[model samples]
Target chain A: MAKMNMLQAINSALAIAMEENENACVFGEDVGAFGGVFRATSGLQEKFGKDRVFNTPLVEQGILGFANGLAAQGTLAIPEIQFADYIFPAFDQIVNETAKFRFRSGNEFNVGNLVIRTPYGGGIHGGLYHSQSPEAYFAHTPGLKLVFPRNAYQAKGLLAASLESNDPVIFFEPKRLYRASVGDVPEGKYTIPLGKAEIVQQGTDITLLAWGAQVEMLEKAAEMASKDGISCEIIDLRTVAPWDVETVSQSVIKTGRLVVSQEAPLTGGFASEIAATIQDECFLHLESPIERVCGLDTPYPLAHEKEYMADHLKVYEAIKRSINY
Target chain B: MAKLLNVDNPNNTSKNDTLNLEFVDEHALAIPTFKMLDDNGELYKDAQASSMDKETAIRIYETMRFIRVFDERMLAAQRQGRVSFYMQCLGEEAAVTGSAAALEDKDMIFAQYREQAALAYRGFTLEQFMHQNFSNEKDFGKGRQMPIHYGSKGLNYSTISSPLGTQIPQAAGYAYGQKLKGDKACTICYFGEGAASEGDFHAGLNMAAVHSAPTLFFARNNGYAISTPASEQFKGDGIAVRAVGYGMKALRVDGVDVLAVYEAVKKAREFAVENNAPVLIESIAYRLAAHSSSDDPTGYREKEEEETFRANCPIERFRRYMLKQGWLDEAEDEAAKEKIKADVLSALKVAEKVAKPALEEIVTDVYEDVPLHLQKQYEQLKQHILKYPEAYPATASRIEETK
Candidate 1:
């Protein structure tokens, strides 16, 4: 095991996937020489050669469309959108073509091996253009799996699993945690199966559910709640679409309260889905209405970014509200 | 007089080299449309002839006739309410069939919705086409897709999508894969001139050129996108000139002439595979049918204009070429048409009577294996459908079947 940041883990995962499978390749704008804007693909082009890891024309639709074609041809394609904010240009490719390829073709054809990686969420002060968390947009798409890893350890494992998956995965790496969050990730290959939530902390007072960078915030909030003699269970939902509702429901059934936190806007976010599902599954056991600590519905702001973002304070307040109720 | 900023600095001055500047008149930049045969079935003098053999010429002529017959029969079926929707490759047969004929079996085809002629040329059977259109249990796509959106893994034809221009960039990537494999194979992407207005067109071509992907971007400038005419689509010198901006080779062919389209595409394919580069071929054809069964030509077009294009019908032009070559006889052509029409009708009759897909298929193939959530959703849907048998009689009836 080695201590690594999310960027390093992602780069290692790409390299490992490419080393294992000759059909695997990576492409995006500035992914080659520049090693990606976040350097998540640093040393990849040099190590894998330009053919296996190369730059593409700066068009998100083309990048994703090409990835679909590559995957359809039995090549494992890892195409990156520079940021989640720019992925909308390729939304049609994901929704209409990539997502529908297998279902529409009746299993005769599919871009199953395509993995689209993009940095998402706020905290980098990237203003509106760079910091928008659009995981909810893709989480709504059925055929596409949405994965967001909180730190290096989870990022590497989930990414490897996504690369090996026989389905298109929209792997959103929380840009806020790219370098900020570090952990002891295994130097060798490991995989964390999608749709499995990891309970990072154990508590019976209330359950705190989150994914991506919000998991860290929730962990901090859980610590704060513990100081107030309020025990909080933290469940990091690695995969948003096929989330481990059983784990969450079980946790909620034990705790009798739920506090879902995410960096995305409260409306139509993946957190809302979790909150709704928990309520349906464990309604009678609930001690309080499901609380959601999320970003404001407005665009990610430049000025007073902290106020616009959901931090530990907001999550702590939601925890208190749930515990009090 | 206004003084030029930084005029005293010689380095800041603009270079005035009019002598070296060569100007191309806008008219000169207009693509030269190619034609191998005239409307009267006469070969144009000094025109380049197709290298196609007599057998191939006869095959192309028959395929065109088969498509025309198929379209006529299917359109009649659609009107009869036997099929939900249909899109015909009426006058644009040469644009699809000829180009498909020119390609090797290994080459991939990424087609727009109207290229049924290409599928037909690639040995997609009448039964297959009928099953897909009828969306029967035997339909390869399992009734998930609409009519005319056909695909076959064996045929190497990517399934067609209703969204315009999505396949254009996909061809580039598939060809890039072929280039990586160092295979002699390439990919041919078909779309209409109107689809060229999409951003994907620019991105696909630019990527193909930059990556030196072995892809042939075949644009059938078939007059209209639904009710919108090509004249209203762009002011440039058609879709062919746009290829030059991407630094790719391009050709504009007379789409009514099968030999011309075949020759152009054959050469384009060779160049693509040989140089590992992309080539664009713009076939200027007319939509001789309504955009689809959902459209009515009278809403936006004139019968006189349709008749003018009908005079230069691609299938007729190819038939005339075959007749001149003595590869086709009038009696044999009529017999072929009758046989195809009969076959299409028979297949339609059989396909329509076929049962709908298994109700379980509604949840299957969403993934390799249906996850638990989908299983639960399917179970709930089954219960709901069973509860309201009158509203979902077809589904309720099939709920008990093991298949």
Candidate 2:
């Protein structure tokens, strides 16, 4: 094991992917000599040469369109959108083309070998355009697999797994943890299983569910809730699309109460999906109504950054409300 | 629009390096269409020779003949309620088949929905065509895509997607992959003048030029994009001169002349691979048939206009050219067309009779493996079908027998 941050972990995984597979290519806007804005792709062009690791013109739709073509031509293409907010430009290519290529062709051709990487979520002083969680939009697409990593170790493992899978994936990295979050990640190749949730801490009073950077906040909330004598089971949902329904359902059944949280808005956040699915599975368990702690429906405001966040304090309060009811 | 793939001002051909800014006249630039063959299949004076030989010429003509047969019979089938829908490459045949003939079989092809002749040129048989249009069990696409959305792995043709210009940028990426691998092959992207209005067209061409990737862009300027005319599509001198803004090579050719298209693409293919750059070719033709079986051109265009285009039919032009060259036998040509029509009808009858794909196909290929929720849903659907056998008679019996 070696000490690495989230960006380092991702860089290591990309190096391994290029080394192991001769057909794999990495390209996006400013991904060449400059690496990425977050340095997630640092030193890739130097190590792999400019041909395999390159920069594309500044067009999100073009990047995905090119990636789809490359992947269909039997290359493992990893194209990065500079930011999650900018990914909206390529929505058609991702939603209509990349998502449907395999199914439409009946496996004759697929962009299944492509993985799109983009940094998401808030905490940086990045105003409207940079700080937004758009996972909820892509989650609605059926053919795609959305994978988000919480920290250094998970980042390396989940990225490796995504590269190895035979389906197109959207790997949303939490930019907030790019450097702040550090851990001892394995030096060589390793993969975490897709669509499985990890139980960070087991408890009986309530279940705290979240993915990506929100998992870290849930852990902090669980710690705060422990002081109040209410034990919380914290489940980090690694893969968000075909999520670990069994794991979440089992936890909700044992705890008899659930609190879902996310960085997106309360109405249409992925938390609503979790709540609806879990309620169906654990309806017989005697508990209060499920609670969702999330950002407000309004656009993420600049001056109201702190108030806009559904951080640990809000999650802790939700836990207390669930336990008392 | 301040978007990535912004529309270019057609009149702004030259860079305004000087200080004063006066809007240039769009009419100042007149792009001459490169024509070699006339309506009588006779070459113009001082025209250059085509690189096509006698043998390859016959194969291309045959593919065009087959597509004409396929389009006619399929449209008839749709009228008879035997098929759901159909689209024809009717007047644009020579443009598609000629380019397909020019490329190496290994080069990947990304096409819009109407280039069925390209697939036929790449050896897509009559049976495969029938299976896809009929959406039967034998269809390689498994009835997922609509009719005319054909794809073939063995033939190296990208599956046809309905969304316009989506394949343009993809062709750039695929060609870049080939360039990196030191492969001599390149990728060709085909779209119509109507699709050029899509942002993807600008995005795709810009990327291909910027990266210096070897991609051939084939634009069939077939006079109309459904009811919308080329005049409404763009105000430029066709789609060819737009390549100049992107620092790429381009050609505007008479699309009805099969030999001219063959020669232009052959030269463009060399430039793309040799220089590792992009090239665009605009083939000027006319849409002889309605956009699809669903469209009726009576309201949009007059019969006189259709008659004008039909007078210089793509297949007839090529047939006349071959007869003039003494390369085709009159009796053999007549007999071959008769046999082709019979073969297409036989294949259509057999493909339609084939059963629909197994019910499980509804959910099988969405992912590598069906997830737990999907599996449960599939099981529940079976139970519901069994409980209401009368309502879903076809699938209920199949599920019962399979269980």
Candidate 3:
């Protein structure tokens, strides 16, 4: 085991996957000699050769369409979209063609081997253009599987699992935690199932649910709540689409209170989906209404980003409200 | 500065250095339109050097004839209320069939909806075609797609999608995979002059050129994209000129001449496979029929133009060329058409009568294994369908059997 950041974990996972499977390839803008803007793919091209790791034109639609073509021909394509905020150019290709290939062809053909990797969410002062969470857009799509990893360990494991899956996956790596959240990750190959959750702490007063960077925020909030004589159970949802609803619901049933947090806008965010599902499954067990600490319904601003983000204080407030109620 | 200055030639006072400026005429880049066969069904004297074998020529002619027959019969069937929609390749048969005939069976084809002739040339049987159009259980696409959206894994034809130009970039990526495999196979993407307007067209071509993927982009410039004619589509020369901008080889062929299209595509396949490069071919043809059974060309075009194109029909031109080579006879051609019509009619009758796909098929294939959510949704749908059996007799009867 080695202490690594999320970027290092992801790069190691990609290298391992490529070494294991000859059909696996990596391509995107600046992913070759430049090794990606964030260096997530720093030494991949030199290690795997230019044939396996290469750079594509700065066109998201073309990048995804080419990936679909490669996947359709039985090649494992791991295409990076640079940033999740800039994925709209290729949305149609991902939504209509890649997602529907198997269903439309009646199982005669499929591009299920392709995985789209991109960094998402805010906290790096990227402002509106670079910092946005668009997971709900893909979660609404039926054929796609959405995965969000909280830290280095989960990033490596869940990414390995996504690459091994037989369905197309949209993997969102929290850009804020790429270097900030470091952990001891295993060197060899490992896989975490797509819909599993990890319980960070065991408590009974209230359950704090979050994913990606919000998990870190909730961790801090849980510590503060513990000092205030209120115990908070924390569940970090590693996968977003086919989330581990059973885990969250079971926790909510015991705690009888829930506080969900995310960095995306309040309306129509994935947090709403979790909140609604929990309420439906554990309505009678609830002692207080589920509270949400989320980004306001506005574009991520440059100067007032702290105000727009769901910081630990917001989570602490939600935890206090849930416990007091 | 006090004197009047010539705006055409700016006066420089600093250094007496001369800067050469020359005017280049746009006409220097003339787009050539290639034609091998004349209107009278005779090969041009200069075009007699084509190296086409007798068997290949005859197969090309036969495939063209089969597509013509299939299109006519299917259009009539649509009018007769047997099928919901149909798109005919009335005048552009030579473009699709000739290009497809030139490629090996292993070479992939990513075609638009109207390139049914390409599928037929690749050995898609009449029964398979009918099953797809009829949306029967036997259809390869499982009745999920609309009529004529054909796909066959065995034949290497990518499933056709309704969205224009989507297959272009996909073809590039597939060709890249073939290149990596060190296989001599290439991918041919078929689209229209109108589909060339989509942003995917630029993206696909640019990607193919940048990656050195072995992809042949065949643009059937058949004048119209639905009701919109080519004149209103773009002011540029054609789709072929755009290849130069992408640093790729391109050719413009007379789509009416099967031998020319065949020769061009054959050479293009060689160039792409040998160099792992992409080539673009713009085949100029005219749409002799409506865009589909639902359209009426008279509203947008003149009858005289239709008559003119009909006179130079690709089938008749190819048949005359074959007759000159003593490879075809008038009586044999007539008999072939009659047999194809009979076979297509029989296939349609049998396929349309086949059972609708099982209701459970709707929820299947969404994933490798149906997840719990989809299974629950399917169960709910089954309950709803069973409650109204009379309204959905075909679906209701198949629900229990699928389970």
Candidate 4:
């Protein structure tokens, strides 16, 4: 095991993918010598050579379309959209082409060998363009898998898993925790399976459900809620689409109360999907209607960023309301 | 002013500094339509003679012949309600087969449908074709795609997608990967003039040129894209000139001339690999049949226009060329067509009788593994189907047997 930040762990995972599979390639804007905008791909070009790790022209749609083709050739094509916000330009390619490559062609052709990695969520003063949590948009796509990592350890394992899986994956890296979320990650390959949720801390009163950066917030909120003797069970739902419903529903059934949190807006957020499903699964057991602590229904704000956030304070308040009810 | 190109823009730069009213119309940038064979299947007076091997030439013609008969029979099957839908590459056989013959078998092909002949040229068997179009259990796609949306990993041909021009950028990326691997192979992306209008076309061509990717972007300017004509599709000089605009080598060729297409592609592949660059080739042709089975040509085009192109069918043009060179006999050629027609019919009969893909295949291959939600839903669906025996006739009996 080695002490590494989220960026280092992710970089390490990409290196392993390239070294393990000769067909694996990493390409995106400024990803070559510059090592990407966040330096998450730093030292990759030198280590892997410009062929496997290189820069592409600044066109998101082109990047994905090309990656889709490369994946069709059975190459492990890892294309990075610089930010999740800029992912919209390639949304048609992702949703229509990559998502449907396998199903539409039956099983003969697929972009299953493709993984799109992009930094998401807010904390830096990126205002609107860089801060939006776009997981909800991709979660709606059926043939795609969505995975996000909270810290360095997970960032390494989850990314390795996403790379190896014969399913198209969109890995949302939390830009906020690139340097902050440090941990001792194993040097080599390890995988946390897709569509499986991780239970951070077990409790009985209520379950705090979130993923990626939101999972970090839930942990802090759970800690504060413990002061009031509200034993909050925290879960990091690693996979968003085709989520770990069995684990989450089981937790909800036991706890009898749930609070889902996210960085996206309240309306039609992934939290809504969780709430609706959990209510049906554990309807008789639920003591109170599941509370949702999510961003306000607006574009991610610049000046009033804290107000727009569904931070620990907000999640703790929601936890309190659920327990009291 | 002198930073680049001795002035501002490559298009607007002039020697003298003066305000002038000028406009470059379509005529000013007139694109030369490449032609090799005349009405008698003889090379044009000024056309470059090709030193193509007899064996390669015969192989191209044979694949072209195979597709010609296969397309006609399949379209008839669609008319008879045997298959759900079918798209025929009836008139564009030479264009597809010649290009396929030009490339190494290992080179990747990203086809925008209608290039089934390319698959045939790369040794996709008649049984494989029947399996795919029949959507039987033997079909590699497992009855998932519509008929004719064929794919083969072994052949290096991408599975066909109905979406237009999406394969353009994919070829650019795949070719770049090949270039990086130091593989002498390149990628050939096929699309119609109609698909070239898609935004992916622009993005793909620009990216390929900028990144020095070795890709051959082949546009079959087949007179129509579904119901729309090439004239209505765009205002520019066909598709090849756009490659120049994107800073890549470009070519325009007669889609009916098999030898011309073969020679052009051979040189283009060389240029692409030697320089690690892309080349765009526009093959001008006419769709003798409707855009697809669903389309009606009488609604938009006249019989006179159809007759004009039908008179120049790619299969006939190539056969005549083969006969002129004494490479084929008229009697043997006619006999071969008869055998091909019978073989296709026999394959169709076999394909029609094969069982449909297993019901479980429906929920499979969408992901590497089905998650809990899908498993539950599938279980629920199975129970529902098993319960309602009479209503779900096709599936009930199978589920009952499994239970």
What is the Cα-based lDDT of residue B103 in candidate 1?
97
- Model 3 iRMS (Å) reads 19.6
lDDT of 3 by residue, A223-305 (tens): 98899999899999888878898999999999999999999977789999998999999999999999988876555543335
Candidate 2 C-alpha lDDT tens digits along A1-325: 9999999999999999999998789998657655766678889989988899876654577789999999999899999987897787689999999999999998898888999999999876443455789989988998999998999999999999999989999999999899999999999999998899999899989999999999988999899989989899999999999899999999988999999999987767789999899889999994999999887654553323444577787788788879889
Clash pairs, candidate 4, are none
True contacts recovered per prediction: 0.00, 0.00, 0.00, 0.00
Report the error of model 4 at residue B389, Å. 3.8
Query: What TM-score does candidate 1 reach?
Result: 0.57
* lDDT of model 3, residue A262: 90
lDDT per residue (tens digit) for residues A211-301 in model 4? 9998988998899988998898999999997799999999999999999999997778999999999998999999998998887655654
- Tell me the tens digit of each residue's lDDT in model 1 across B103-217: 9999999998899989988899889999988877888877656678899999999987666687899999999999999889999999998778767898899999999999999
Q: What is the DockQ of candidate 3?
A: 0.01
Residue A227 miss distance in model 3 (angstroms): 61
User: For every model in order, what is the number of clashing pairs?
Assistant: 0, 0, 0, 0
Model 2: DockQ vs. true structure: 0.01
User: How well is each residue in B161-228 modelled by candidate 2, as lDDT tens digits?
Assistant: 66567799999999999999999889999998877766788889999998988999999998876655
Give the DockQ-based CAPRI class for model 3.
incorrect
Residue pairs in collision within model 2: none
lDDT of 4 by residue, B185-221 (tens): 9999999987787678998999999999999999999
Task: Identify the runs in model 3 with alpha carbons over 4 angstroms from their true place.
Answer: A1-325, B1-18, B22-27, B401-403
Deviation in Å, model 1, residue A269 alpha carbon = 8.3
